[model samples]
Target chain A: MLQNVPTRQTIEAAHMLIAPYIHRTPVLTSAFLNNLSGTNLYFKPENLQKIGAFKARGGLNAILSLTKEQLRNGVTTHSSGNHAQAIAFAAAKVGAKAYIVMPENSPQVKISAVKDYGAEIIFCMNTPEERERNVQEVIARTGATFIHPFNNYEVIAGQATAAAELISDAGVRLDAIFAPVGGGGLLSGTGLSAHYFSPGTRVYAGEPEGAADAVLSFRSGKIERAPYVKTIADGLLTYLGDKTLPLIREHVADIFTVSDTEIIAAMQYLWERMKLVVEPSGAVALAALLKNREAFTGKNVGIILSGGNVDLARLPFGKEV
Target chain B: MLQNVPTRQTIEAAHMLIAPYIHRTPVLTSAFLNNLSGTNLYFKPENLQKIGAFKARGGLNAILSLTKEQLRNGVTTHSSGNHAQAIAFAAAKVGAKAYIVMPENSPQVKISAVKDYGAEIIFCMNTPEERERNVQEVIARTGATFIHPFNNYEVIAGQATAAAELISDAGVRLDAIFAPVGGGGLLSGTGLSAHYFSPGTRVYAGEPEGAADAVLSFRSGKIERAPYVKTIADGLLTYLGDKTLPLIREHVADIFTVSDTEIIAAMQYLWERMKLVVEPSGAVALAALLKNREAFTGKNVGIILSGGNVDLARLPFGKEV
Candidate 1:
C-alpha cells in the first residue's frame, strides 16, 4: 500500500498493476514548434488517454487498489468534469457500483459520459461544500468509498507513471518537465517521478495567472487560495491539498504563471502545427515555457498535455457554434 | 527509373527513397469508436505528415525524381491546397525554385503556408482551366517542368507509401482499406499498396455526395465531373486523372458516397472520441465505413485520414469566427 506520499517502489508497482488498463501514451514532437519556441519540446499527450484526460490514471489506480469486498460496496467521488468520468469508468471496469456527486450545472457531454459508464449520478448545488455534502450522503447510504480526486497517495502514484513513461520513452535526457498545476496531483506526481527516475532532471509547473494558487502555495509553503479565478483553463482552478502541496514544495523547482491569451496561442499552434486536439489547460505548460523561453534556450523540455475536453459548442477560439 | 504504374518493388523503393524525409506516421485505433461502429478501425493519420498531408510523400518523390539539369529551371504546379504547400516545401528542402499557381481566393492560412515555404505564388481564377493555364504560362516563361498534381506516376508511387506503411504498422491483417477520393492520388496509391502488399484487403473510397465525381468516373470508366461541387470536404473536390483513374478502377472494390451531414458527424466523432484533429475530408473514409457499417461488421478496416488543414476561422461544424 502507498503511504502518505508514494515512494518509488509503490509508484512502480502501481504502474505495473495499471499497465493493461491505461495507454502508454506516446511522446509527440513538432520540429516546427521546436523552431518557433527555440527549444526542443517533448509532449506527453495524456489528452489521448482513456476518457480524454490523465484523471483516468488516478481514478483507475485508486479504484483498482480497493479490496474486492470494498469494491462491491461501490466508490464515490465529487467532480463535475473529467474525474467524474474517470471514477465512473474505473468503477465499471472493476464491476463496482460508482456514485458520482456532480454540480447540477455540469456540461451535457460530461453528464452523458458518466451516464454511459453506468455510474449513479447525484446532482448537487454547484459549490464545494454542497458537492462534499452530497458525496457524504452517498457514502452513508451506500457505504461507497470516497476517492479523492488528487490528494490520495495511490492516485498520485498512478499519475507519476505518465512522467516515468516519458522519461523512458522521450529518448533524451530531459533537462526539465512541466505540467499544469490544478490541485497539484499531476505536478507533484510528475515531480516525484523525476525525483526517483531521473534525479538530474528538474520539475517545474505552469499555473494560470487567473487561478494562481500553486505559485502562492509554493512561496508560502502551505495551501493558499488564488487571488482570483477567471481563466479559460478551467481544469486548473483548484487549490493544492495538504498531501499534494508538500510533495510539490519539495520536488518542484519553480512555478511559472501564464495568461489565457498565451495559453490560447499555444493551443492554436498545437492544433495547426502538430494537428493535436488539446484543451486550454492542456496547453498551459507549453505557454509557460514559451513565455520563459529565454531562460531555457535550446534545452530539452517535456510537457504533459493534461487533458482534451473542450466544449465544441463554445470553443474558446471563436464565436459559439 | 520506374515507368507508368508503380509495382511492389517501386513502391518499396519509394518508401526507402523518401524514408529520410517523410514521417512513417503511426496507425491509431480507438476501442470506443470500434464499439460504436461495430468494426475494428485502424487510422493511418497522414494528417500528421510533414506538410500536414500525405501530399508531402508525392511531392517529395516527384521532385526528387527530377535531375539537376531539369531542376535548375525549377518546378511548377497548380493547387490552392495541401499539394501546393507540399511542392513548395519539397522544392525548398532540395534547394530548387518552386512556382505554384493558386486560386486568387485561396484561404489566408494556405497562402501564408506557401509564402512561408518560399514558393513563388501566381494566383489565378478559381477554376481548373484557369489554374492549368497559369501553370502553363509560368512553365513557358521560366522553362520549369509542370508537375501534374496526381497524374504523374512518381507522385502516385509516393502517395502509395502511406498505405504501405499502414499495412506494415497495423499488426492485424486488415480486411479492407478506405480513403476519400479527390484527384485520386491517395486512393489510387492506397489501392496499389493493397493490391501488391495485402492482397486480401479490398480497397474502397469515400466520396462526398456534393463532389460525387470519382464514383461517377468509376462507374462510367472515364474521367467525369461532379454534377455540383459543394461540400465541407474541400480536399475531395477534384476529379481523378488518367493514371489515377485507371489504377483506382482496376484495384478498388467499391465506392461509397457520404452526405455532408454524415461527414461532419464522423469528423466530430474523431475529434471528440479519438482526440484527433482531422479535417472533414480526412474523416470521409470513416464516414463511408459508418454509412455502410453493415457490410463491414466485425471486420478490421484501415482508414487513411488524408489531412488536417482546416481554416480555424471557418470550421465546418460551427459558425464562422
Candidate 2:
C-alpha cells in the first residue's frame, strides 16, 4: 500500500543514501513573514543546498544507489546547469567519473562549477534529440549508466527527502505546501512528502505563467505541455518527464501560475526584506503566494525554495528578452 | 572590575529583557564552507532576526529594561538605518513612543521601514554633532530617555545574547571569533561572550580598510578615529563608542581590515554560493578569512553574521565609493 505513497522510509533511505553528498538544508521560519501573510510560512531552503539547488539530492541518491558495475563503467547526463553540476558532484563523491553534456550558451559560472567538480564536459546542440543522441553515444562508448535528471523513481524519491526533512525539522503539521514544478521531480517528492508526513496537508504546485505545463497537466488530468515554453526561471522550462507526471498526478492537489515581473519582484522582496537570496525558479512559490495572497492567508503553508543559482553577471534587469 | 567588563550578569539581564521581544536567530554551518576554509565556521545568522539584523537585540533589550516612568516619557536615538528600525520596533513592542534622528540622505527603503515600525522620524543634518543635538533636543522636548544606539551598557549586553545563543546552539568550543566592529556593540558583546562561555577563545574585530578606526584603537591601547571613513558597509561608519571601547579593549585580542572590493565579493560569494543574503558589513569577517586564507586555514573560527539589511537597489556592485 505504501509503495504508491511516499513514506518516511523512502525519504529516510534517500536521506541515508545521499547523506554524505547532499545538504540537509535548514527549514527557516520568520514571524515577520507569518505576520505579513497572516499565515505561518515555513521555508525549506533547498536553495542553500550543495550545487546551490535541491537537484543534488536526487542526483547524488541515484549515483549512490547505482550498482558497483555501473560505477566501474561511469555515469552520463545532460542538463543546462544545476542538474549537470549535481550529477557531476555526485559522481565525484562516489569515486566515479561523469560525462555531462551541456549547451554552449550555458552560463560560464555553471560550466565552471561543473568543471570544478571534476566532470568531463561535452558541448552539444541545444535540441532534445541532439542531447539524447550525445548522451546515448557516451553510454554506448563507455558503457556508462545514463542518469535521467528527473524521470526516475530513485530521483523522485531523492527529491522527496527535502519535504521529509522540512516536516520533521519544523515539528509541526502544515496545513498546505507550495512547491515549484519543473519536470515535476520536486513536486512528486514534495507531494509524496505531504502525503506521508502530514496526510491531510494539501500540496499545491507553483508554475511560471508563461511555462504552466504542470498547471495544464493537473487541470486536464493528463500530461500536458506549455505551448513554446518561455520563462526567466530556466530550471522550470522543461516539459514534464514521463516518470514525474504520473506521480505528480496522484499527489499534487492544485497548481498556480505567476508572472515574470512578479517573480523578479518576489525575488527582490525576499532579498531586501526577508534577507533571502532566492533565484527566479526558487522564487516561484513565494511569487504565487504574493500574487494570490487571498487564497493562502491565515493558513499554515510550507514553501520549498527550490534553488539559488543566479549568474549575477547576466541579471535580467533592464532589457526584456 | 565591572566598569569595563561584560559579565555574565549583564548578558543574563539582557537576555531576560529582550527574550520576549527579539528573535533567537538560527546558527547555520556548512560542511561546504568548512571544507573550503579549512575551519569550523559557525555562522550566527542575525540576518534572520526580527528587523533583519542583530541590532534588534540591543534595541529591544534597552527598551524592555526601561522603568515605568521612562516608558511613559518616551525614548530618543540617532542611527543610520538598521538600529533605527530596531529601536522603533522595540519601542512599539513595549507600547512606548520613539523619536529617531536619521541622516537626511538615508535610503528611502530603510526610512520607510523605521517609519513603519511606528517611530516618529526626525530628519537631521548628517554631521555627528548635528544628529546628537537633534536627538537631545527631541529628548528635552518630549521628556524622553536617551537610548544611545550602541554606546549604552544595556545595548552592549543585549547584543551579547546572540553570542550566548550561538555558543549554546553550536555546542562547540570556538578557538577564535571574528565580529564586525563599528560602534563596537557586537564586538563588546562578542568579547564578553568569549569571556563568559569560553574564556580561552579570542575575539577579533573585523573592519573595512576605509574604516579602520577600531584596528588603530586596538593597537594604540587608546581610543582612535579613522581619518575619514567611507565604505560600502554603511553600518560600520561609526567610531567605537565610550561604553563599548573599554569592554572591547579588555577582552578583544586584535582587529583586522579588508577592502571594499573584498566586502562586495564576499557578499556576492555568500549570496550566490552559500545562498545567504549578507550585507557588506556582515561579510567583513568572512572576507578577512578569504583575504588572509593561510592565517585561519586549520583553525576553528566562529563568524557572527551581523545583519542582512541590504538595500538591493543600491547593491554596491563595482564602484569604489
Candidate 3:
C-alpha cells in the first residue's frame, strides 16, 4: 500500500497545477514571540488560505487530477471540518458536484460552510464506520470518486506545496519545521518537502496528547490507533494513513504531544498578543514549541498554522482570554 | 492655530524617518467581503502595526523629530486608548521617559499596556477636561513635551505614511479611501497621502453616530464637539484637532456616520469571515461601507483598519459573536 510515496517532482507538479486556484498566504514573524521563545520563528499562515486551511491545496489538486469521466461522476468525501469545505469549494471551482458526509453532531457553522460552497450534504451517525458506510452509499449512488482527506498520493503531493513555498519564501534553511498531525497529510508532505527542498532542515510533528497514536506508532515501528479521542483540537482526532505513515517514518525526526489546555493557551496567546484568529488545531505546533523551548532555542524554526475554522460560540477558554 | 499643517513632503519625510521603527503591515482582501459589499476592497491592516494600531506611526515620528534637549526632557500625553500605548512604546524605543495621563476609569488592560512599555502613569478624573489639566500639570512638573494624540503636525504627518504605503502597494488608483475619524489624525494623514500620491483618489471619513462630532463639524464647516460621547468605538470619542480640521476640509470628500450596532456587526463579520481580530474602532470604516454599500459599488475602495487593541473580557457582542 505504501510502495509509491510522493516525491519532490510530484509535489512540484502539484504546486504548478494548484497555484492558480490557491492563495500564497502571507508569512508572519513576531519579534515579541521570537524573544519569548528564544528562537527565530517564521509562521506560514494557512488560516488565511482559501477555505481557511492548507486542506484547500490537497482538495483542489485531487479534484483537478481526476479524468473527465471521473469529474462527470463527481466527487465524494467525509469530513466534519475544513476538508469538507475544501473539497466542496474545490469541486465548485471545477464545476464538479461534491457529496459530503458529515456526522449529525457537527456544528451548524461547518454545515453552512459546506453548503455555501455548493456541496450536497449527507448526514451520518457520529462514528467512523457510519461515516465510511454513508460515504460508500453516496459514491455508489452517484458513481462519484472518493477523495480521501489525507491518504491519497495526489493530496499529499498537493500539501507539500506549502512547505515548498515556505522554504523558498523564507530564503533561509530552517533548523526544523513543525506541523500539527491528524491524518498525517500535512506532516508527511512537510517532511517530504523539507527532505527535498532543504535537506538540512528536520521535520517535527505536533499531536494532541489525548490522541497520541502517531507518537505511539513512531515509537513502536508500526501503525497505532487511539483508544478514544478527546481533545479540543478536534481536527487531530483521525488516525494516520498507510500512505502517510511510510513518509513520516522515513523523514520525520520527532513527534511531540501537547495537552488541550496548552493548545487553548497558545490559541489565546495568538489572539491576544499576535492578534491572529487561530483555531485550536492551528496552535498545537506552537504549543509544542513553547512547551519544549530549550530544544529549539536560538534556532530558526518554521511553523505551519494549519487552519482557522473555529466555532466562535464554543471557544474552549470560555468567554474571555 | 492651523498655520502649519503637515504637507505631503513632511509626510514623506516622516515615512523615511520611521521606516526602520515600524512594520509595513500587509494589505489583505477577501473575495467574500468583495461579493458582500459589491466593491473591490483593499484593506490596509494597520491593526497589525507596532503598538497594535496606526498610532504607532504618529508616535514614533513625533518622538524621532524631537531635538536632543526635548528628548532629554521626556514626552507626555493624555490618552486612555491606543495613543497612550503608542506614546509609551515609541518613547521606550527612543530611550525617552513617557508621562501618560489617563482617566481613572480607564481599563486595566490599557493601563497594563502603557506600563509594559515603561511609561509612568498619571491618573486623573474620567472627564476630558480633567485629563487635560492633569497632563498640563505633569508637563509643568517634569518640563516634558506635550505630545497631543492627534493635534500635532508631526503626528499627523506620521499617520499619513499608512495611506502612502497603501497607494504604492495596491498599485492601483483607488476611487476612494475610507478611515475612521478619531480626532482626525488618521483621516487627515490619509487625505494628504491620497491627495499627493494618488491624485484621483477621494478620501472619506467614518465616524460613530453616538460620537458624531466629526460628521457635524464636516456639515457645519466648524469644529463641533460631541455633547456626550457614548459609542462602542471608544477610540473615536475625541473632537477633531485644529491641525486636522483644516486638512480634512481641504482633502476629505465625505463623512459617514454609523450606528454602534453596525460597528459591532462589522467587527463580528471581520472576525468570523476574514479571521481578523479587529476592534470596534477598527471596524467603523467597514461598518460605514457595509451600511451604504451602493455608494461604493463597482469601484476600487481602500479602507484603513486603524487598530486592534480591545479588551477581550468586555467584548460588545459577548462570547458568541
Candidate 4:
C-alpha cells in the first residue's frame, strides 16, 4: 500500500509510472528574458502539458500506482477544479470510475470538462469541511478509495516528477526553482526533487498575498492555516496538508509572497511575450520574479508554471459566474 | 523604396532580413483531432513566435530591410497595437528609433509594452485615413523611413517566411492550410509560401463575421474596401490593403467566416483544453474548423494560430475591466 513510503523512492517511481502518459513539456530559455532580468531564466511550460497542468502527472502516477483490486474499487477526491479534472481524466484513462467532489461555486467550464470525462460529480458548499465530508460520504457509499487531493505521499511524489523532468530536460544545475504554493503538493514535490537531484539548488515557494499561509508557515517554522483565502489565484487558495507541510519545511529554501496585481501583470507578460495563457496561480512563480527582481536577478532561476485551467470569462477581476 | 515591389522574389528576400530576429515557431500535430475532424490537423504555433504573434516576422523584416541610410534616419509606423509593438521591438533590437502612431482607443497594455521598448507614441482617432496621414507627417518631420504596417511588400514577404518555417518544421505535406485574414499580411505571406514550397496545398483565409471584408472581396474577385469593422478580434478588424489583396486572390484557395461568439468559444477551448491563450484573431482558424467540422472531417488541415496576445483584463466579453 506504500504506507511507509520513502519520499525519494516514491518520487522516482512516480517518474517511471507517469512517463508514458504525461507529456515532457518543454523548458524554454530566452536570451531576451536573460537580458531583461540579468538572470538565466528557464520557464518550465506545464501550461502546455496534457489537461493543461502539472497536476496531470501526479494524478496519472497515483492512478497507475493503484492495485488491480483498487482500480475496480474506483477513486474519489475533492478539489476546486484542476485536480478534480486531472483525477477524472487519469481515472478514466485507466477505466476506473472517478467521483469528484467540487465546490458549487466552481466554474462551469471546469465542471463541464470534468463531466465530459465521465466522472461522477458531487457538488458541495465552498468550504473545506463541507468538501471533505462530501468526499467521505461518496467514498463510503461507493466503496471508492479516497485519494488525498494534495496531502498524500503518493500525490506529492507524483507532483515531484515535474521537477525530475525539468532537471533532466534542461541539463543544467539550477541556482533555485520557484513554484506556486497551494496545498503544498507541488512545493513538497519540487522541494524533494531539489533535495535529491540538485541538493545544492534552493527551492522557493511563490504565494499570493491573500493566501500567504505557506509563506507565514515558512517564516514561523511551523504549519499555519489561513482562515480563508481571497485571491485572484484560485488555485493558491488551498490550505496546507499534514503530509506536505513537514516536507516543505525540511526541504524548501524560502517562500515569497506576491500581490494579486503582480500575478495579473505576470499573466499579461506571459500572454503577450511568451504567447502563453497561464492562469494566475500558474504565473505566481514569474510574479515572484517580477515582484522581487532584485532577489531573483542574475540567478539561474527555474520557474514552474503550474497550470492553465483558468475560466476565461472570470479573467482580469474574477467576476464571471 | 523597395522598388521591386510585390513579387515572389521580394517576399523571398525579406526572409533574410528577419530570419535572425524572429522565431520559427513549431507545428503540433494531434492524431486525436485529426481522427475526430476526419482531416489531419497541423497547428502552426505562431503564438509561440516572438512578440507572441506572426507580426514579429513582418515587423522585424520591415525594420531590418531598411537601408543603412534609411535606418540612420529611423522608422515610423501607425498601428492599433500589434504592428506598433512589433516595430518598436524590432527597432530596439536594431538600434534604430521608432515613431508609432496609434489610435486613442488602443488597449493600454499594448501601448504600455510599446512605450516600454522606447518608442515615440502619437495618438489619433482610429480611422485608416487618419492613421496613415499621421504616419506620413511623422515621417516628414523625422525623415524616418515609413514602415507600412501591412501594405508594403517587405512586410508581406516577411509574414510569408513564417509559413516557410512552418512547412520546414512540420515536414508534413498538407492538403490545405488555414490562416486568419485581416490586413491580409498574414494571408499574403502564407499564400506566397504555399505557392513556392507546397504548390498543391490550398490556402484558406478565415475571417470574423463582424469583420469579413476579405471573404467578400475574395468571392467577388476584386479588392473590396471595408467601410468598417466591429469585431471582438481587434487585430482582424483591418481592411485589405491594395498590395496584399491581389496576392491573396492569386494564391488563396478560399475564405471562411466565423462569428465573434465562435471566436470566443474557440479561444476558451484552446485556453482550457489545449492550454494555449490564443487571441480572438488567433482563434479564427480553429473557429472555422470547429464551426465547419463536416467539411474538414477526415482531411489533412493546417491551421495557423496567428497570435496569443490577449489582455485578460480586456477579454472581448464576459470579463469586466
True contacts kept of each: 0.53, 0.62, 0.51, 0.68
Which pairs clash in the backbone of model 1? none
Question: Which runs of model 3 end up more than 4 angstroms from their true locations?
Answer: A1-3, A318-321, B1-3, B318-321
**Cα RMSDs, all models:** 2.3, 2.6, 1.7, 4.1
> Docking category for candidate 3?
medium
Tell me the tens digit of each residue's lDDT in model 3 across A77-141: 99999999999999999999999999999988889889998999999998989999999899889
Query: How do all models score by TM-score?
Result: 0.96, 0.95, 0.97, 0.86
Write the candidate numbers in order of decreasing DockQ.
3, 2, 1, 4
Range of the 10 consecutive residues with the lowest summed lDDT in candidate 4 chain B: B312-321
Best by lDDT: 1
TM-score of the A chain in candidate 2?
A: 0.94
Please give the range of 10 consecutive residues that has the lowest summed lDDT in model 3 chain A.
A312-321
Per lDDT, what order, best first? 1, 3, 2, 4
lDDT of 1 at A273: 84
Candidate 2 off by > 4 Å: A1-7, A316-321, B1-5, B318-321
C-alpha DockQ of every model:
0.50, 0.53, 0.54, 0.39
Interface root mean square deviation per prediction: 4.2, 4.6, 2.7, 4.9
Candidate 2 collision pairs: none
**Residues A201-299, candidate 1, lDDT per residue (tens digit)?**
989999999999999999998789999999999899889998999999899999999999999988888788888889899999999999998888899
lDDT per residue as tens, model 3, B77-140? 9999999999999999999999999988888878988998899999999887898899889888
Using lDDT as the yardstick, the better of models 1 and 3 is 1
| lDDT value, residue A215 of candidate 2 | 82
Model 2, A74-125: lDDT tens digits are: 9999998689999998999988989999988887877888998899999888
